[model samples]
Target: MFRFEKYNIADWFSFYRILAVPLLLAFVWYGERTLFTWFLLVSYSTDAIDGFLARKLKIVSARGSQLDSVGDQITLIMGLIGLIVFEIAFMKANYGLILLAFIPYILQMIIAFVIYGKTTAFHTYLAKTSALLQGVFILWLLFFGPVYWLFYTMIIIGILETIEEISLIYMYPHWVKDVKGIFWALKDDRRTIRKKTVKKNGV
Candidate 1:
């Protein structure tokens, strides 16, 4: 039942992740803090499950990767925007500081898209970890109170991570080329496995 069939059950999980964005927005917009928190938790959990299932089940495809990246960004951006609006509306925190935090965050997305034609460097482990940590940190700040030191620490780390990723694209153009090569290699490996399975089944 858990078998990986290309564009089958596994793809539904990807679609579910995408669908969570609107539900998350609704919860936050309605000021249902409890419901919003639960929604965020579930959304973050699915990020891990989707990646695990894709890799372990050998269902990783370019389309799946693209969908996953877009979904993650949408979830994160909406959450951050909601938190910022909440802070301004309720807590009356410094508008300048919030705007300061927002500028770099939006720049990261813009730069990635302009450079890589995507919202993120989806293939980079550091990029992924940076995004995951940033998401967690943002959620922590929203549900809990402001941990100023922790928030600033994550912001710094995020800036460094973005710089490192962009540098790779500029300094080593071949790095992205290498990623394409890796994808082809993975596809070839999958094809080999299918062939072996077919032979064993006497097809």
Candidate 2:
């Protein structure tokens, strides 16, 4: 009944990862703690599976890359939201650190959209490690409750990530050249506009 081999394994894993989000939500909302934990583990495991399949099978399509990014962000966001809601409803206290860390990420997302039209690809090793750390740390907070030192660590990492993205934006000209398609697109658009202006001027 399953035809996994016919499709890219990474794509299939990414799809499953996205699908798990709603399942996780339902489990958390219904107060099924055991089930929610299992779902979280499964969802997190898919991260490794998808990365491995992409590297091993060499099927890293742009679509797969986009899907992987969406899947990751959704997973992390939902997990944090769940923690915040749980804390507020049960503990009657603020999740101040999570809220603060979110500020730079929100700014980064906005800058990415305004500057590049999409969130930049997970391009550097530091960026990837930061993401993984955030995800694992958030999940740990959810399952075990927040620890003061860990929250501080997350805040520091978030600051570093913000700096990294800002640096990337300022250095885009140097970086885009390595990504041939983005380079070509920028060059072609400039050439097209110049040609149009020259034609209009009878030059």
State which candidate has the highest lDDT: 2
TM-score of decoy 2: 0.73
Query: What local lDDT score does residue 177 receive in model 1, on the 0 to 100 scale?
Result: 28
- Candidate 1 regions with alpha-carbon error over 4 angstroms: 1-10, 89-101, 171-203
State the lDDT of candidate 1 residue by residue for 1-203, as single tens digits.
55455464556666776788788778767877767776777777777888789889987877677667776777777667667555655335545555565576677677666766765434555556666776777677667867777666766667765665555444432213224323343454444675577779998
Model 2 Cα lDDT, one tens digit per residue, 1-203:
86766568788787887888788888778877657766776777787788788879888766677677677777777666566555554324544655566788888888777876776554445556666777777667667766667667767777776667666654462213112233344454544675577779998
Off by over 4 Å in 2: 1-7, 89-94, 173-203
Sliding window of 10 residues with minimal summed lDDT for model 2 = 173-182
Q: Which 10-residue span in candidate 1 carries the lowest summed lDDT? A: 172-181
**Model 1 TM:** 0.69
